[model samples]
Target: MRHIHDAPAGLIDFLFTELLLSLKDQGYSEFSLGSVPLAGLEARRGARFSARLGAYIYHHSTQFYNFEGLRSFKEKFDPEWRSVYVAVPPGANIVAVVADVVRLIGGGGRDRVGGKASR
Candidate 1:
């Protein structure tokens, strides 16, 4: 899941279509979408959708959150994790996730979590 606002349009839709087709092709007729919150990430509507879609496709990201961290976070809600992949265009800037994580942790170099900026 873990999609930023910058993700390309139709990306989620295409993924869903492919996933459903793949599952049917594999003779699976029963499936359900689940959702969980990312550890320490902001809780928003987009985040909620990302988590649900991620759970549906069993997709996990490794940039901002590690498998261990995601596992721990999702385990609180008793979710099952499945492995998936994203095929990025060659030379695309795929480091946005990492950069976002850095910004969040580094607080844009101010080290602020709330209204107080760290020195």
Candidate 2:
């Protein structure tokens, strides 16, 4: 679920509707729209600068990812979003671990098969 380059308005709506209907006919009632990175992040009171910076990037950086748009699109289907988190071992380099994860999950320098990007 990425951008529709030069696609006509409502094209995505049609495609999603068709896909959902097909899935329903195939006896699949539950559809999982994949996770949107940082879409539901929350900073507790007295949060640190890193947490605030991450939230800012998630909300504003459309060139990197359409985070807000993806969440809005998924909401149209009446999804029940559950919070998910990742844990790292104590004393590990959190920054490096997160960088690796970004490369892995963000398809950094990946090839595309058909119309979809893959790593």
Candidate 3:
């Protein structure tokens, strides 16, 4: 999904359409483009600390992630988005839960396969 923004107008769209058509020909009825982290988060009254933090990061962390562009690219397909939720038990620290989820994303202490990403 990491495409050059300078690509000619409609080039990305053409490619995406072809890909989807190919998948359909393969008898695939659905396609998942995966999660766009920090996308669609909003800050409002009574929002949880984690939600607010996610919103702030989404707005200010473009140097690290092109959240807006990615979200826009994914939206072209009329995709359905699922909500992300974190469960914190009583007395649990939200920061710790977030950190653990991040760790799980980055190899998660699992043994690498052929020195590549985790299985």
State TM-scores per candidate: 0.29, 0.72, 0.68
Candidate 1: give its CA RMSD in angstroms.
16.7
lDDT of each: 0.49, 0.69, 0.71
Candidate 1 lDDT over 1-119, as tens digits, reads 55679999767657766887899999997555432223333344666444454443323555534544544544543445554434445554435433443344434646555443332
lDDT string, candidate 2, 1-119, tens digits? 55568989878878998999999999997988777766655566677544565577677778866778878888888888887676767766655554555455666635543232334
Off by over 4 Å in 2: 2-4, 43-45, 90-103, 106-119
- For this target, which candidate reaches the highest lDDT against the unseen true structure? 3
Q: Is candidate 1 or candidate 2 better by TM-score?
A: 2
The segments of candidate 1 whose C-alpha lies over 4 angstroms from its true place after superposition are 35-119
**Model 2 TM-score on a 0 to 1 scale:** 0.72
Q: Rank the candidates by lDDT, best first.
A: 3, 2, 1
| TM-score winner between candidates 2 and 3 | 2
Off by over 4 Å in 3: 4-6, 87-119
Deviation (Å) of 46 in candidate 1: 32
**Candidate 3 structure quality by residue, lDDT tens digits, 1-119:** 54687888888789989999999999999998776766777888798777887788768767755667778888988998997765668766665564455444434637643232332
Order of models, best TM-score first? 2, 3, 1
Q: Please give the lDDT score for candidate 3.
A: 0.71
- At residue 11, candidate 1 shows an lDDT of 76
